[model samples]
Target: MRRVLGLLVVVFVAIVCAGRDLYEVLGISRDASSPEIKKAFRKLSLKLHPDKNPGDDEAAKKFAEVASAYEVLSDTEKRKKYDMYGEDGLKEGGGGGHDPFDIFSQFFGGGRQQRQQEPSRGNDVVVPLRVSLADLYNGKNIPVSMRRKVVCQHCHGKGAAHADDIQTCHECGGHGVKIETRRVGPGFIQQFQTTCNKCGGKGKIITSTCPVCGGHKTNFGDVEFDVDVEKGMQDGQEVEFEHYADEFADRSAGHVRFRITTTPHELFSRDGDDLWMDMNISLKEALVGFKKNFVHMDGRIVEVNRNEITEPSQVITLKDEGMPKYQYASEKGKNYFTSRLLILCIGQLNIKINVQFPDTLSAEQKQGFRELFAM
Candidate 1:
């Protein structure tokens, strides 16, 4: 019976692809490699899919043609025959009776023999991580401890004590859904399908559940790892650990992301790559000029000097003295090692001057100032 159906399909495909060259349909050379053929098919199928090109008849037809071409060309034996003798050779039992959407699903999400559906993904876990502003200036490694669900080791995530103890659901015929027809009116009938309660949509029943996980297929466990806080990483930047979230039976684990939060510094504030700070100066120093040692975030000393009178509300700009410029690993290239030199990669530091005036002037000081200024 299946052979008859296969023959009918072959005949239909031969009719549709009668004079069309399979290689031309896929826009690839006759000697294209297997990976090339697959790549071409994936690209064309995505663009010409029926869902993407809704209400477009020409695209739908081309989509079918592309799928047909890939179906025949992807198979080693069928491809050999089609290459040698053309589409007619496939009708002689070269094995080209597969569905096109099945191929798409196999590449996109589900493996062969499964319905076309998006791959299941678990939810991501985001945690807040606080660090000092100095940590962002100088890269730091922060150790983090997390509690996540891991697959049961004893049952290997099967949810059953033994493989033989698992059986297909009898209620839905292992499809996990039941269809029923009901009378809607005197002469009308309605049909609808619902998830089978017996199997909870799992399509399998475990007679002997795993003692450790109790058929849940996972257990909570503690895990620890170091989160690298790269230099100049912006606030709220996430450090991601892939596939480290809670585990499920058949779904892929999501990422564990740590959102970096930099703590406020007492002496410095940042804007993009620049650092702003307030510098307090005494009235005498502002008038006569003075040199002061300014401590940087990494304990480096920066000399703040003025040879002339320093006015209040003055701004002093220091080049390449702020935060380190953040560079991605890929962007580092050959200059990564040299970037540690502040002159090579850094930002500006702006210091705003605030001069404190003396509350009371002595009579001798006022007289001296009056005589010096010839008032």
Candidate 2:
């Protein structure tokens, strides 16, 4: 009975020591593909890099553990050994003499030593900006307003109420990584690796949460900006705001992009760089000739006059009346006016005349008189 109890206690200790779930370690479901496992590892590496979080021993340990798990699972031979013998198989050189980190480094191109840090640029954000057609034609600077995420002023972007609240991570032993294993099929086990949970893979912990942001690194608000639209600028053209994106804790930011949108105009339709306006004329005016004038968008007067007969569907060209040329040249454009004509005809009229024909009028004259009188 004493020997049996000791055996049971040893088994319990073994189970307790091997507590991590491989599936959960890699943050993937049981059915995750090999490629998916690799992608998850890369993402976690970037997040929990030792350089990103300094002096975090737990994060470093977690990182190494995640790397080890990936090394075994990513290989067919080692995977088989791990499947049969578990961690013992890997430890006893059943994996054919392979260094897990070496394999991981080869697959992910190896880790880099900390180098000179550079100021990070912000991200770029895009918003649709609407403008009138007239504004596009004449060119204008549109003032735009939007709300964006900015750094918190109270905590100086540390996201904590005070510095003392921050603490080192305990789970990964400051390595910021963890390892896990799963049974794939009969006699086959797959291993997965992931960031350490206790430290959120950061290999560090915040003993005291920030009172302002509650340990969340970010906050939100409004930002106003201007978009300069050039004359004859086409719709959907992008207006850029350099380095105006969301603020980061490390003071890195991105840019803001604005897409220009034009509102539909009642009087005109735009085609490329040209502007089109339709004018209607009566048939009488088209035939007898007439003068027509209309107001332009810029409050300029445009007139069309013709003394000679104008045919229907006749187009008259007006120089320098179209939209201003964009980018290529500053030359003015031309305007085309169309004309329609209608003609009217009256019936012949009859007249009464009393005339005395010569006394010697011929028989032809008498016939003519009889015909005329009958009509």
Candidate 3:
């Protein structure tokens, strides 16, 4: 829990700030190069962009700051003005350059007619997770190993040796979309549009492909994830592991879904969230008082006692002894459980009435039986 809390704190600090300087916002020195500034802006803009963090006003504002920094630092004339007169100088040097999204889109692919970019997610991988009913009732964590596609570490999914090594498409001239004119009749032509074939519609090609992933920008690898089996988990229910599926270059990772499967128990049977078991009592024990110890799922021993006469196939229910409720509360203050127990009691005394009387009983035994019946 502390680890999760710490991660959230890190994310908060990374997204929000208290008026840090332009260089500090980009986390670069004042002497950083143009290429270095470009790299920094690309990374931060992708993370804090309004496109990625839609509806998050804080992140959107932060992205604007980042883009402003890159807008000044990336231009030679504006960088000189900023270095001399700071942000005020940049405003005097030129109108705020361009919109942050436009800058981002231009850096990725330079075109004014921009298509709406939807974050891409890979195909979801669903697998079965098997567990005992006791595990489900008590709740537990199980480690699961998966084989999936991850971004190439060597090139960081760029699929190139260097950012400068990427070349603009020869056919589309980096617009990604191409226009074609077809001759229909005399002096009449039809205009159509299509994607650039040379760069596969990306508007750029890597001069050097990554050695590890062979320009696919992804690598096949095995990863382990902890699957939490929450209390009162139902069979065939799905537990999702977000952003853990296949990853691609400049694309969002899909989710991994785990379907819960509860295994059958030999001694106990399950009915929804409740447990059921059978118990037998002797004739004397059923007639008088009796107590017995029952070993439970976690090896804890529980006492089962009865003083009244039991009937065959009779059910005894115990409340609050079942599975814990998943985010379900019984009252305002008390957290309740969804599961319980149903015990089937079989009485031995019921069988004696149908049996024939024993002829070999001794005089003492006969007298004892007579005394017992008299009582």
The C-alpha TM-scores of every prediction are 0.63, 0.49, 0.56
Evaluation by TM-score, superior candidate among 1 and 3: 1
Q: Model 1: per-residue lDDT, tens digit, 143-256?
A: 888999999998989989998999999999999999989999999999999999999987888899899999888999987757778789889877766567898878878778
Clashing pairs in 3: 322-339, 322-340, 323-339
For each candidate, C-alpha RMSD in Å?
17.0, 29.4, 15.6
lDDT of 1 at 173: 92
In model 3, the worst 10-residue window by lDDT is 344-353
lDDT of 1 at 220: 94
Candidate 1 overall Cα lDDT vs. reference?
A: 0.78
After TM-score superposition, the amount by which residue 318's alpha carbon in candidate 1 deviates from its true location, in angstroms, is 1.1
lDDT against true structure, model 3: 0.66
Candidate 1 wrongly placed segments (more than 4 Å): 1-118, 183-191, 329-344
Give the range where candidate 2 is weakest over 10 consecutive residues by summed lDDT: 335-344
Candidate 2 global lDDT: 0.59
- Winner on lDDT (1 vs 3): 1
